[model samples]
Target: MPDMPALHALTRSIDSLAPDIVTLSDRIWDFAELKFQEFRSADLLIGALRRNGFTVRQDIAGMKTAFIGEFGEGKPVIAFLGEYDALAGMSQEPDVDYPAEQTPGASGHGCGHNLLGCGSLLAAIALARHLAEHELPGTVRYYGCPGEEGGSGKTFMVRAGAFADVDAALTWHPAPFNGVRSTNNLAVLEYYYRFKGTAAHAANAAHLGRSALDAVELMNVGVNFLREHMPQDCRVHYAITDAGGRAANVVQARAEVLYLVRAPEMSQALALAERVNQVAQGAAMMTGTEVEIVFDTAATNLLPNLALETAIHANLVSLGPVPFDEADLDFARRIQATFTREAIRSSLRLYQIDGDVFSNEKIDGTIPLHLGLRDFEGRSHFRAGSTDVGDVSRVTPTAQCWAPTWAIGTNPHTWQVVAQGRSPGAHKAMIHAAKALATTGLDLITSPDLLSEVRAEWFEKIRQEPYVCPIPDHIQPDVGWG
Candidate 1:
């Protein structure tokens, strides 16, 4: 445990700096930029860190928006990772029941990444200031990770050895509750399968035409049946990206389907992906079409670290949850009404939260330490999705904490979530998160013994084989589209 006075003082200091942090969050929220396109958000965070006396490095890992800011020196190169990317087609005005669109069509900060980035920056700056004042005997690095929402931005950074030298890393996300990520996440692989065939007039010469679409449909059917035999937790989803020619009178010559395969471990995911490829091949052969597959992206599952998680949970308990006002509660109630009654009940049950209305009602904000891993629910149940953070845990000791920045039952990638991105309750949550993260960084820096234990445990639990990149080196990030 850390000194109570020091931790309390740090928390107070962070609270005092809430206005500045909230301003940053608001600016990023207003920008509402997409993954790998967080030019303004990244610049704002980097510029602020530089002003605070940290040396800055832009374009780390060959990414234009990716950057690293560092301060202090020596053992335990602790890094704080930050992400700032909005979702597509989620723009909305603040605090409104009716969806107030930003434009006819555009992106919005539906994921609360604006808060994610600024909260981390606040932590980094606070920790840097603490180190300078106390002459702390360790290093702190702020990683401006971009494209977290489906961009595999951190995976590329990891491949480039951006985090190779770091002793430990800490990150946080904006969620409906405050808790440490305990369970492992499913590994994922994404790719596109295409079939080529001869085109001919559909009505005049139907026998002369070979339909590539038939191969795609057959492949999908085969994989759908394979799901019955696969593990219960394993997931597979696909979307037809192309169906060849548009003319109804012509047979389709080329067709493509984007597929995402996920499992409890990377090895399983890879094996399943290979099986899916075989199914595609069989379909092509049966249909007399040529098949081609292209790898898009891949990510490993999260490796849980008890040591790091304990430290983060302690920090979370000390800092406590954000306090909410009556007005906040009123607004949250309205938002809750927008969702289905069953959704509200399910969300409350998932996080063990209690609330009657939609307005932002601040709940208890203490990180439960003794909560066993088995007691923690799987993320698969809460809004089905995958993250590249899963990859980071495989290589190093890593843990992520979630701070309640949204109303209960607020779903990500929605206009409602975007509306709450800059709310007072959200701002308060980010400030509290910054304090917790900074305090944890301090603990790692001051306690060399703790870092060693964490590293040892991480190594013991990690797989023996070297990590294989899911996306081949040939596929570069297409930032323009994301």
Candidate 2:
């Protein structure tokens, strides 16, 4: 727990700025910009940070929507990662009972990043003020990370030396349940395989036509077959992006398939990607088509910081449950009504959490820490999803927590989570997240020994196995729809 004076100050500061934080979150939610196109979202945040006396650097790492805000000066540069990008095709109106798109097939904050970016910014602003008023010497930074959903914005930033000087980093995610993010996620590799063939009339010259679509299907089949032989944690998925033209009378001359390969480590992920590429080549050769492989993005698996997670967990416990009212529970119950029993059970099984934890139909208190939060001996839960924050973790001692901002059993990138974005419950959790992050950051800033321990562990881990940004230098950010 943080010192009482600092804790009280943090709480008071967050409470004072609660209205602004909610406004920022709601505004971003409304904007629903996708990936690297978050111009308005970035502008809103940058303006707010400048207003709060932060020196804003726009377009860091050559990504337009990616930027960082800095204040104060010192050795211990503590950073709070903020992601504002929304998922494509998930646009939905908040406080709705059913699937109601604000704009059909548009972007939405289904991942709760509207709350994510704003909450971390709130912490950054509060911490900046606290440092100035108390004459503290640490620097506080807020990174306006774009394209977290799939763009690998922070991974590119890591390669650009963005986090080299940071002593530690902190961030949080909006989730259905509150807990420390201890599970290690898979390292992801994304690629687009473009196949070109000879187009011919399907009826008149079918023999002369080389079907690129056939190659795509073969590649997918090869990947699916290889999955059985790969490690249980490894995942390979492909999406047919371009299936030539929509004419049934013409043979497909061009087709595209996007592949996402993931594993527990970067090395493993790369090896798997190599095999997948080989399958693509084989498919191309067999179909007599030319194949062009384009690397889109990649993120390394998260490197966990035990000491930092301990601090975050303690701070989260100290802050206690977010004060939710009966109306919030009522709304949560309504959302819960939409989820089928199998869907709820599937969510429970996926997280390995007991169903009774959400018996109240809402998550107000912190969930119990998982026994397998850390994998000292390669024994931990496998997080199938990927995030650019994993790249930041590679560079410094980083830790993130999940704050409950939606009804239990709500899945990300879905209408359910989007529908709760503007709820009072969501606002309460967002404020609490800011409080937890700010308090934990304050503890790290003040404690030299603790920070040193975290850094030492981070250094030792990196020394044992150095970090190499998975995305190559030549691969630029492709913010288009995957």
Candidate 3:
């Protein structure tokens, strides 16, 4: 770990970059582009990185929005991950408490990726500047990861060997609380299964038609039955993306269903996915339909690095909680008023802590120092949502932290979350988070003992069961419609 004086200097260094950090975050939030289409957001970050004397590389691993910015040289190359993709149909006007959409159901930064991307980039830039000023022998990289919403952008990057040389990784997410993200998240597999059959006129040749929709329905039923036999920790969900046609008279010729299978581990999730495929094939056989399953992507369960998490938490405590004024509290109270009692209950249920985020509106002004350490498998606050960062963790010694950027009880991908996008509190929390992440990066770069212990744990874990890309070699990134 870095000494107190050095840590203070690093914190001050990141704080000085607050203006540029907030500006870049607001710019990306304004763009509000969807997955794989963050052209303007990517350009903004890339430009800022170049201005800070970092070498920029565009369109990594065939993702147009994905890029990498590198600074410095030599061993212990540390990478800071940044994601800038927005969710669809979540747009809301800034600084509003009501459910008002900015463009009436357009893309928005409901998940705070605008803040996420910029904060991580700021961490990288601050670290780069630190290295240059002190003439340190280290490397820093800012990974411009796109398509995190239903698109595994980082998983694709991992498969492309993007983090092959990275000695360690640090990242953070904008959330409703300031704490260490020590939870073990679910591993997931995403695939689209299509069923094709002969189409026929319902009135004249109905008997000649084989209903592909029937196959889809049957497959769903089979999957529901399998749910009972599978691990209780597993989750299976599907959407009938195409149900033949809108016309009731026609016997549907073609139908499609997208499936997402999640479990506690990658091996278990893969097994569950195989059973799902079998169910699909059975459905096809029974209905005389030809089924084709196209692989989309998958994310491994997040593996935590205790060494890194503790170091990051120390930095968070050193910075203390983010300060909020009367105006900030007033706005947050209004936003909290919009949420129902059930929403507040759900938000705090996972943490099992006091209810400060609801009434206080600025989150619990404390760091979760021993977060998930004593819990079962470090999953007492297990994340139900999947992230491409899980894939990154498999390859590198990675850990993440969380910073409160919105009012409590505001669910992600909702207009309520987007409403807080431009709040002064939100910007302050983001800059504070950047300092925490950058400070952690500095500790790893300077301390060989800490980095070695972290990597040793990571390697031993992987050695027992090595990482296998969930997406097959033939499968490519399935970019969603913008």
Candidate 4:
């Protein structure tokens, strides 16, 4: 554990510097950048680190938007991961319900990644400041990880050994609850399936034409039927990206479908994906078409690290939750009105929160670290989404925490959440999260025994299965329309 004085001073420093951090977050939110295109966001973070006396390396992993900032020296090389990407069609004005945008139909930070980057950066800066002041013996690095939304930016970074030498890593996401993530997240694989057939005029040579669209439909039907037999937790989703020729007068010659397979573990996800591929093959055979599959992105399931969870939970408790003001409470109430009572009630119940609404006030106390796999209604658990973070957990000791920054039932990638991302309430949550992360980093640096125990537990939990990338090396990130 970190000394009490050091923890207190760290928290105070974070709180005192809250405005600067909030400004950074707000600027990123205003920029509303997207994956692989976070040029300004990356520059902002990298520039901040440089100004703070940290040496920075840009264009990491052949990605212009990816970079690393480092400070200090010695045993534990702790890296703080940060993201700054927005979602398309989520542009909105701060605190507005309707689609009010400075640039209409533009991308926005609906995922709250603007805050994610700023909070992580602030945490890193705070830790760097502490180490310099106290002469701490450890190295701290900040990774400006881009394209987390769908670009698999970290996959490239991890492949390049960006995180190989780190003793430990820490990350956090803005959410509706504050707790250390100790449960396993689902593994996911994404790919595109293309079918090729011969095109012919429908009326004159329909019999001779093999419709690629037919193959796509058959594949979807096969997978839908397969769902009933697969494990209940397994998930399969797909969308038609191309339907060949648009004119009904001709038989379609080509079609494409994007498929995403997810399961509780990576092995299962891969197995399910293979089964899906078989379905595609069967479809191709039945339709007299040839099929080709191209993998886009694959991510592993989160390997829970109880050791890191415990350390992070301790810091979460020590820093407590974000202190809310009366105005903040009023804002929360207004947002709560947009949701049905039943929905709000269910969300609160899932997280074990009693109130119908959450105020700006700090949480009552520290929440116990949760180890069991659990689901939250209207939040992360109720909705299953894949993230590249899952891959990092499989490779090294990693843990993530979440802090509530929006209305009770606000979902990511929605306009409502995007609106809140630019609000003062969200800013406060970001600051609180930064303090917790910084405090946890300090504990890791000051306590060598804890880090060793964490590493040991991580090893025991994983049992030495080497990490395999879900996205094959041949696949490149496609920035084209999904």
Number of the top-ranking candidate, with TM-score as the measure: 2
Q: Across residues 141-220, which tens digit of lDDT does each residue of candidate 4 receive?
A: 99999888777788778877898888888999987666654555678888889999999899989999999999999999
The lDDT, on a scale of 0 to 1, for candidate 4 is: 0.79
For all predicted structures, in order, the TM-scores are: 0.89, 0.94, 0.93, 0.90
Off by over 4 Å in 2: 352-380, 479-482
Q: Write the per-residue lDDT of candidate 1 for residues 1-482, one digit (tens) a residue.
A: 87677787677778777787789889999888888899999999988888889999999777899999999988778888899998887879987755889775788988888998889888888888888888877888999999987788888888778888888888888877666656657888888898999898999898888889999999999999999988888899998989886788888999999999999878899889999999999999998899999887777777777888788778776665566667666667676667765665555565554322232332221211111111224232322357888777766788777777776676678888888888877887788778878888888888878888889878887656457767667777757767
Task: State the lDDT of candidate 3 residue by residue for 285-336, as single tens digits.
Answer: 9989999998888888887877788888878777777776667767777787
Identify the leading candidate in terms of lDDT. 2
Candidate 1: where is the Cα deviation over 4 Å? 352-384, 463-466
**Clash pairs (backbone) in predicted model 1:** 328-360, 329-359, 331-359, 332-358, 332-359, 332-360, 333-357, 333-358, 333-359
Models, CA RMSD each: 4.3, 3.3, 3.4, 4.5
TM-score, candidate 3, is 0.93
Cα lDDT of model 2 by residue, 400-447, tens digit: 888778766678878998999888889988898899899988998899
Worst 10 residues of 3 by lDDT: 368-377
Measured with C-alpha atoms, the lDDT of residue 435 in candidate 4 is 81
RMSD of 3: 3.4
Report the Cα lDDT for candidate 3.
0.83
Candidate 4 collision pairs: 324-360, 324-361
